[model samples]
Target: MKVSIKHLFAAVTLFASSTVLADVLADIKPLQDRWAEVNYALPEDDREKAFAELLANADKVVGGNPDKAEALIWRGIIKSSYANAKGGLGALSVAEGSKADLEQALKLDPTALQGSAYTSLGVLYSKVPGWPIGFGDNKKAKELLLKALEQNPQGIDPNYFYADYLAGKRDWAEALRYLEIAKAAQPRPGRESADAGRQQEIAALLAKVQKKLKK
Candidate 1:
């Protein structure tokens, strides 16, 4: 029997895509549990199918309404998360869709949903790496994260995301500041313990980053 490299590559790609989808869905399960009625019990592969349904539904809804904005935001968010789950497969579609949804949301009303549009963009940017992950814009990520914070100075979501961003840049001090700020916000049960564990992880990573910076 003869082996073809192309076939091997295809198999690997399929495997990798499957793995990413599994992991992303796993991560979302908790979030789904937290948001009971808002989330559905659909398999990962059916996410795009759901998005198509949502887009069709949105078309019937009135544009420029707060409700419309909310619908668009969530549609975009689901697409983004699904794309992420697929490890860049359909990522361009997801990123573009997310932007369009948020754009429509902003056009409807920039202040709608407590600046959720900005927060969603920030989430998209933070998770999807810049220049490599199809449409990750770290600069825009920072700007949107800041907007989210300004919109809700008392929210933990923004703080947690911003802290994650700061950690990505290896800015330990700044990340620590944001993490500490997030600590004061309402935490999920045992989240404080998780945060403490994460703190230790950050400390370890920062030590390496600092050492590399020195050399």
Candidate 2:
């Protein structure tokens, strides 16, 4: 049996690409773990410092793999989480940086990590103040969140963030539906901590939506 030169070359290229992807995932796993730890396990008063430290490590990862969408996505996540922890006007700058990182990740690969860039960016758009104060736009947030749901219908982050958006819009019924789906999402391997933390958030939101419906 003889393999054509073109076929051999293609195989080699595919293998190299796969290897690079594996390396990127391996490198970002630590970032992901630490983020969940800082965001969930740490006390609220302590999280800002922890997240700031994590952001430094995330910066190194993004710098090392500037083209890896996964790395950029994680960096963006860390930045946004740090901003949330910091709070107030001072945090807006970090949030803007987070938006930029997520945008870059989208350009590199919109579907990387199950469209996480879209989910995270959508959350930013939904949460931030609009116009003079910030770039938030509910319309853009819905569009991005819907795209993320299309890409990852059953993903925990997509459903959870979309539900949060819907809740913000006072669409209680729709929010409840998505929160239910998010609550029941299958846990991701090697992301047990994140899954657990997100489940807690989902439960809290679910209670809020359910109470709103009863009101």
Candidate 3:
């Protein structure tokens, strides 16, 4: 048996690369959780300052790691900056950038990034409409949500987004199922809000959405 020096070097490099990726994947989630908390705490009337903070953090996430897939998730999220709060053709500009990032993320690694790219696209579509139009699209939303679920059934964002879509479509049963899954995935209290307030709000909204859909 003859093992060449090249083979040994290649094996070492692969191991190192995998370790780096694992570390990044591990770190990204906590950052994501903090950002989610911040988003939840922000007042309902506006999302600009929150969006600004979100974009800044997301940029940091992408900047810290040059990996295409990892960068893509942050980029996709940043792209949808004010789509939900101040949507219009103006918001469309941001959405375009977000779309590009998610697409790149998918191309790089559809399975990695915890299906973040797909989940983000699902979220954006659910909140937005057709091109040059407003911010809302059920069909596209459903498609992306299913894709995200297919990629990562256990992911929180996917469950949240998909659950929202189901509620939008008046599928209360399914929506509840997914929302429960999302809640179970991480019960941690949001940092943005003092303590239980965020939880109460989220729970209330979930209940309201479910009730509306049930009717």
For each predicted model, how many residue pairs clash, with residues at least 3 apart or on different chains?
0, 0, 5
Candidate 1, residues 24-126, lDDT tens digits: the string is 4344333333232222345667655555554454443334233455556655666665555455455677677777788787777666556778887887877
Q: Look at candidate 1 and tell me the lDDT of residue 191.
A: 41
Q: Worst lDDT window (10 residues) for model 2?
A: 126-135
Over 1-215, each residue of candidate 3 has an lDDT whose tens digit, in order, gives 99999999999999998998877766566656655555566676657666766776677777877565876676577557545555656777688678777877888888765677888887777776765475457787788789888887865667777877787777778888887776666544343342244345447658877677667
Query: When superposed on Cα atoms, how far off is each prediction in RMSD?
Result: 19.8, 0.8, 4.2
Q: TM-score of each candidate? A: 0.57, 0.98, 0.74
lDDT of 2 at 131: 91
Question: Once model 2 is optimally superposed onto the true structure by TM-score, how far is the C-alpha of residue 140 displaced, in angstroms?
Answer: 0.6
Best by lDDT: 2
Give residue 16's error in model 2 in angstroms. 0.8
The TM-score of predicted model 2 comes to 0.98
For each candidate in the order shown, give its overall lDDT on alpha carbons.
Answer: 0.63, 0.95, 0.70
Candidate 3 regions with alpha-carbon error over 4 angstroms: 1-10, 22-34, 44-46, 53-67, 131-137, 186-202, 209-215
lDDT of 3 at 170: 77
